[model samples]
Target: MSYLDTSDPQRPATAASDTNTAVTSHAPSDHIEMSEVVKKQSNGHGSVNVEEAQAQFHALARRLTRQSTQHNDKSGGDIEKQETFDLLEYLRTTSGKQDEAGFAKKHVGVTFENLRVTGVGGVKICERLMKCHDEFFLSPYYLAKSLVGGPSAAPKAILHSFNGAVHPGEMVLVLGRPGAGCSSFLKTITNQRGSFLSVDGDVRYAGFDAQEFGKRYAGQAAYNMEDDIHYPLLSVAQTLQFALKLKSPGRLLPEQTRAELNDEVLSTLLSMLNIAHTRNTVVGNEFVRGVSGGERKRVSIAEMMVSDIIMNNLLAANTCHQASRAVVCSWDNSTRGLDASTALDYAKSLRIMTDIFKLTTFVSLYQAGEGIYDQFDKVLLIDEGRQVYFGPAKEARAYMLSLGFRNMPRQTTADYLTGCTDPNERAFADGRSAADVPSTPDQLAQAFQQSKYWSRLVAERQTMQAEWQGEGDDPSGTKGQFLQANKEEKRKHVSRKDPHTVSFFGMVKTLVWRQWLLQIQDTVSHLRNVLKPSLIISL
Candidate 1:
């Protein structure tokens, strides 16, 4: 296993507040303090109260002293000099009484902007832009794009387009029908199209444009396709170790460093996925050996996190903050034990950026249970290829019920989907015949064309249409196009061995001779047995 090479030049620096003053004099903390001083003085107009002005002056002086101390610890360079000049200008502008209010506003704005920049830039780079223009964009990293297909194509599409995005510490569920392109989606995202498809697509790693994204995110993502588990080969640690080796070859920590890294990786994974009990347990297999399905999923995740790239990304994403903080505390009255501060600290460490856009196709999400609908943020329900409902999950269910679809208590998502296509349910409630139901893939595709979901998709498509509208309508040279020139063209070749070869006949002759030799030996043994019996009788 070898680590993939990445060309991103900007490596993430240490966390803003973590730098030691002895090492880096102009610490991020000092910059923050200086910015705050500038803000306060500017907010205080020239006619500031004597005591307040004095206090502000002292604070500024203290911050400057700290900055000086830090600067003394390290040799100043062009970057440091530029930073110092910026801070000085900020201080000078804020100290003057005439334009205090204006200076204060500008100081606060600069401070916040710097913080934002630092935060975004400090995270391990995991993705980059592959192709970008005024209207069209494509990430080097592949995302699962689900679409409908016929029975034959449906399975392939489902496997190809059914994928979930896992960013470092978080787990994303790729929910869809058995043939709804989930597996195919995983293969596409991971760039394993050769194994899944006879034809290849233009695949590249995510973050190719931003080299850091490629370097940090290259092998951090893991996929667990729906396959039967084979449990006999290795222990849990061995399995994780193998996966880690594949993810990061040269970059792996030495044995002494591995103990801490392993603990951190295992703990982070267990806490995030809500599975911590099966740490050392063997996964069970029929007449062999393994863990349960859920445990296997956790193990796969663990392997990904052990990689340096994944760990760095996960830390940057603030996923650890969420996992650490969401602890369920139990108090033992006898022992008198409960570390509330520690628990709170753990909780504060985890954070997740909210996803602004969420798209779900009918085939992607099915109804789970009644209250469980609230668990999901967005929902899109599709029947055949058409969108039946799309909105918040709760609202979608309500809309369905209003449209005369009955909701049964304790009904699972699979059951709800089946009910949607049931003939009796439709006829009794809406006076619709079985003809209304979509039977074939073509019909389903047509229905999808008529639905609101189709309309939304069309609208999105039109927005992007202008970018490539005149770039050759025949689609011959488009960079990322998945469609091929012709469907029937053979893209692969195979060679057959000649059946009349002497080598083939020789193998058969050898087997026959061995069988003959065994038969002769058996006959000789039988004769010996008969002779021994006759000799005994004569005696």
Candidate 2:
């Protein structure tokens, strides 16, 4: 039984009919099947509710744990998760039943709480001004500064006390400006932290610790990095196939069954992630012009985990295409290097895959287009690793406005909110004294902690947990529907801020012009210096 059952149910049907059934023979093709789940969104888009999705993902993760597993040699927190996930997933599908024979118990989900990560502080202790305009490192100031030794080493706080959750069945878009600690947060959860840091946190799956989660039901969570790396010579198809072979339940399943599973898995993942076109193409590197940047990013996703990559090649070699109840661990910024249109398209593609495959995704992004931003079911906005907002993406605008931030008209939602975090860029309608205005990311985080926004987030999380407890460990969705869950009411608010006068492109142009001017000034100054000596000689 494959950990994730894609063949189960309910392709959302707005394109169906009932009156004249084809040839009037069997049951109506348009009618909702017993296994089909209907989704209704208040905003007209049939997106899942944030709280509801979390409950469902966690439940699915719990349900996917197998009693007895074939592969027992998988080691480490990361691989073990994949080994269990891939094996259970392979068994689930091969066994030929979605729920029966312990196949349904292999869907894995993830949750993390109160995460705080810190590292060594900045590289300098004090300002060392040069005595001369064009000076050498041997200057008195430089020598004195060197004598004092390196700047006082202090612990750098990368991620503040961050509390958030990644629910299944929804795409969580984590956004922040540069150095906002997005990478730090993602790394902490994926257990990818370096040796120079201190981390205090707990990531639980179905109410279990991260290590135990990997042991019992691993591979529910898969991470996609920003940088995409691939072997230049290996064909894309060959790469995915190799991943499949390595992670598939080879020991237990017969060779033919494994082969059939591989074919099915590979075909499904390629089609779902929209990279089917690159199947036979060689995954090339810088030296070899192979796939496009976007495609390369897709390839990185295809390699998240041995179990999950099998799923992506197929996901957490963990569940179905690396997601079912699989937590989509994405520092979604993986698209930052791509153009705006490609980045937007990539987000859309991810949204489609999440909805179609019933997977949960947690993605970190620096930018989100109107189209891309709306596609996400939930948005997690963090500043310096502090939770600014955690709820429906649509309500963020109003929430900020209520806090006295006016949005720039036509400005991308991502920029407007992140801009507010920078006190210099923000001006509250309520007005404030210099002392009253918050400064720095930490101050912004502290302000949020004191505001109604933080209270709201806490209440929302508490409510989600309360409801989960009351309703038991399962979502309202039908049993075996991995990503399907409750359709509870989402908090909604009318956007109160008048649109501002800025645009992302306009800002970019402005910065470009400023840089151009600076460069020209430097070039002219250099010319003047050179010509001054020549002019004196001529005279």
Best by TM-score: 2
Candidate 1 residue 72 C-alpha distance from true site, Å: 18
Runs in model 2 lying further than 4 Å from the true structure: 1-110, 122-154, 194-196, 214-218, 250-256, 271-277, 304-328, 337-341, 356-358, 430-439, 451-453, 460-539
Q: Could you tell me the lDDT of residue 71 within candidate 2?
A: 51
Per-candidate TM-scores read: 0.39, 0.57
Candidate 1 lDDT, 247-286, residue by residue in tens? 3221222222434444444444444433345555554455
User: How far is 199's C-alpha from truth in model 2 (Å)?
Assistant: 1.2
Candidate 1, residue 482: CA error in Å?
Answer: 22
lDDT of 2 by residue, 452-502 (tens): 546666665565454444545454322222222100000122111211112
Best by lDDT: 2
